[model samples]
Target: MLHTIKQYFNRKGLRDPEYEFLFEPYTGEEAVSFDCETTGLDVHHDEIISIGAVRIRGNQILTSEKLELFFNPQQEMRVESIKIHHLLTCDLVDGVPLEEGIRQFLNFIGNRPLVGYYLEFDVAMVNRVLKPMLGITLPNRQIEVSGLYYDKKIAAIPQGNVDLRFDSIMHDLDLPPFAKHDALGDAIMTAMMYVKLQHIKYLEKF
Candidate 1:
């Protein structure tokens, strides 16, 4: 864990004493399932349009308490990107600035372990904004839902190939589908997946 933290800082060209708290071990019980809607796929150029997350305490997903924040990205919306998330510049005119949006997200998540389908991309987009403001990427540990599903599946069928698609996983687990391409809906669905995966006998034995 320490090695990963050092590598992240070195790659990002950052050094800060106050941000060291992020490297400490996480002892909390809560985990946040999060998702981000961005302008495009290029992390270096695209900016976040929204962030949604829900918290899980043990096996329960606290849907009542969730973060759904929108931001005004000062960039032209791509036609393809607009088709994916359906948010245009005009739709985000009244949204908060990136700085305020990020601050609120950080406050909502704190040090809780983060869970998501493909978390690295989301984390990278978040860190792109956070590195400049906080001098650190997310300090919280991240748990990929795909990884959890893979572990459980491979255990059940040692030599069988596993399907890791979001829809496939949800279907296999008997979970209902939620609205895709929407941050809040996706976050809640991901949260549900995490809770269910935790109760699997294979995971419980470990």
Candidate 2:
């Protein structure tokens, strides 16, 4: 099934070679900001309910190029998870099947590096689906905004060491207000942080 999907994409001229990052100067153009809402935080046991992503080029979000997918989970959703993402099982009537959603997500991402908050877990959930269904792993580089903010802060403030909490970064950076755990809201916040960090990087260089 996965092979046929890949072949279809290839036939449509959608397959691109993987990206190689040389030891060159950094630029913000080649990044895709993404976020996932799941049935729970446990990547080992929980399931993804929906995913949203936007490609950021030159510090601008290409809204027209965004990808949004809702996946029907194999497991039943816990009450707590539904309260968080608001995706009831009944709400997923139009959602794509898990396999098809994964295939579309993989094709949308292609070889672009991913940007998100605590990205490893999302990547793990995505790979969990792929490894079983497609017999392949996710093949994109990832950048965590949480880690990047921490590194930037540690470099900027040598004397004041502070843990990098999401709320802390949001407050410190004067980022826009957001709903605590909404997938699309988080994705937009992550995109905003990425753009702000690029400006900070530029300042440090100049």
Candidate 3:
């Protein structure tokens, strides 16, 4: 089945040879939940200052083995952005360069499916740097925690509308709120959310 999907993507020009390994059969035994703190929200222009990820296996989050990296951005730090992540300019001066940081990140994540809250933005930020060095963006599968929560909430009570805010979902699910806006903190929070969402009463499939 995975081979067929890879063949289809290759024929359609969506598969990059460099990323072929990501299309191999997935055991579904584990996934990585990741988050990034960027210079700004603009995926095309902003740079990632920090990245954090933890592994999830069989409903257990492995906090011991993880990746947390910080990078120096080419662009000057914006005051508004600093307030959010608190990664000051001085703090990033000793940080790793973009290519090296991302290289380590990719190595750490391997081919595991990625999970997070509003995850595409983080993926885009990483890809912006990756395409240049690797000739391909991350080809791994992605899962969004918020989308899962929304699906479960709606299915439980079809007409019931739930606040999708990070804090709101954490509150409703009885998950402890972590420090907001920091990459590692957010990654940990999303990991916990993913575990809880897995147990929610739902449709036939996860």
Candidate 4:
């Protein structure tokens, strides 16, 4: 009921008529797992330097059809942030404008639900522009990999503390070593976590 109310305002606030498709009903079962590499963690001030996402149809991750975009930042990036994403400003010279990148992302994602490790922050970062440009936040459903993992853990250990750390979850799941640490790499890995968790849920029913 709360989501319906919020989505009502989101649709009523539409500033761009062309994006009306975003509000359309989605019958497809596919979802997109995405990640954003920003200049910093501060969504209020930091900028998204790059975005990456992959489509998931059923239990399979369709890596061949993926979206990877880089945005050229007008300002310099901090040293601490560089250590995190390893993306230097010089490497973004070929990137598209930030708005263009966001537009492409919206088109690529369409009405599909979003999946991610820490999705709220990434959505907030994108909404920084989306609200001003289109007067709407992403209306797509969100599936958090960590939240899913937490549900599984808490079911097993209701009183025990659950480690929601990315590395910890990856280790517990026995997933493969994914060393790229880039936006796309993280998205792909998070997709694996989502699919594995879904499988675990199915297996638990028996």
Candidate 5:
């Protein structure tokens, strides 16, 4: 279908053939749950400062093996953003360059499907960096935890609203609130939500 065509073009125009494995059909069950801390919400102009991801295979979350990467933005982060992400420019002074961090991330993820909460923004942020460097965006399939939650939740109350806020969803799922909302912590928590949601059948009654 569309992906098959995109894959063909991506393979044909690949900047580095060494990354050809990315175009390879992923036959594995693993999905990477990832999150990125960024300078701002605008995907057109903002930059990612750090990325955190973990792998989930079947029902198991492999917490022992995880990817946590920080990049040197080399500019002062906005005070409001720093308040939320707690990643100041000073803290990332020794962090790796954006391209290096991105390479490490690509290696860590391979071709696994990606799962996340509000995943579109993060994917957009990564694609902005990836499109120029690789001549293609991530070909990995995406599973949005919030979307899964909505499908599972709206079965009983088709006319009612479902609060899709991160905290509200976590609370409804009975998962523990994260101590602080960093990229890794949020990614891990979102993975938990994904796993739990997979086991829950949609009930007709609330």
Candidate 6:
């Protein structure tokens, strides 16, 4: 585990202490908005089935540069999970092996900060595979869209913070509604949220 962690830090360019603060005061040329679909929600027990991400630059989502991958999980899928991600065991027949999926995901993300709603879980799932399969971990800085939305709301209205639910934020921002539970759809929603949050005046100051 220690070796894996060390290797991850090295691979992600997170060896520098300053890198820890990279996502706090967001300043960057590009940021990758990400989301994932999993077999279940328990990070300790469940497994990731698919991952999707899109890079945002200059207030635009670079759709042409998106990354989407289906992963073969070591565990069997729970029936309930199918309602969410729509990935049945049969659907994953062509899924990539864990190591290849991790490597592709890492290559896609590179050193850029990762953005997602509830990102820690996705990061943990990725780490689970990386540490065991490749003796590495995912070390990229993470930005949670939920937190960003809450911060933006607080800044906009000094009275009180609003709920960070995805639906709430989408309704508030007037973003086009889409069916949830799909990785690509969620990633696109996250990208839209990130753009909308950036336009918030108080958030722009930072």
What shift in Å separates residue 180 of candidate 6 from its native position after superposition? 5.0
TM-score of each: 0.86, 0.78, 0.87, 0.95, 0.95, 0.80
Which stretch of 10 consecutive residues in model 3 shows the poorest summed lDDT? Answer: 10-19
Question: Model 4 segments beyond 4 Å from truth?
Answer: 202-206
Cα RMSD to native, each candidate?
3.7, 7.5, 4.0, 2.5, 1.6, 6.1
- With a 3 Å backbone cut-off (N, CA, C), the pairs that clash in candidate 5 are none
In model 2, how large is the Cα lDDT of residue 60? 85
Pick by lDDT: 2 or 6, better one: 6
Clashes in each model (backbone N, CA, C under 3 Å)?
0, 0, 0, 0, 0, 0
Of the pair 2 and 4, which is ahead by TM-score?
4
lDDT of 6 at 179: 75
For residues 87-128, write the lDDT of model 5, one tens digit per residue: 888888888888888889999999899999899999999989
Tens digits of lDDT, candidate 3, 93-191: 889888888878877787899999999899988878776676666778889999999888888677666678988888888888866668988898999
**Candidate 4 lDDT, 1-206, residue by residue in tens:** 99999999999999888888888888998999999999988999999999999999999999998999999887789888899789999999999988888899999999999999999999999999899988899999999999999888778777678888888888888889588788999999999999899977522220
> Candidate 4, residue 203: CA error in Å?
11
Comparing 2 and 5 on lDDT, the stronger one = 5
Candidate 1, 145-205: lDDT as tens digits: 9999999888877867788888888888888997666898999999989999888855212
What range of 10 consecutive residues in model 5 has the weakest lDDT sum?
197-206
Which residue ranges in model 5 land beyond 4 Å of their true spot? 203-206
Order of the predicted models by lDDT, top scorer first: 4, 5, 1, 3, 6, 2
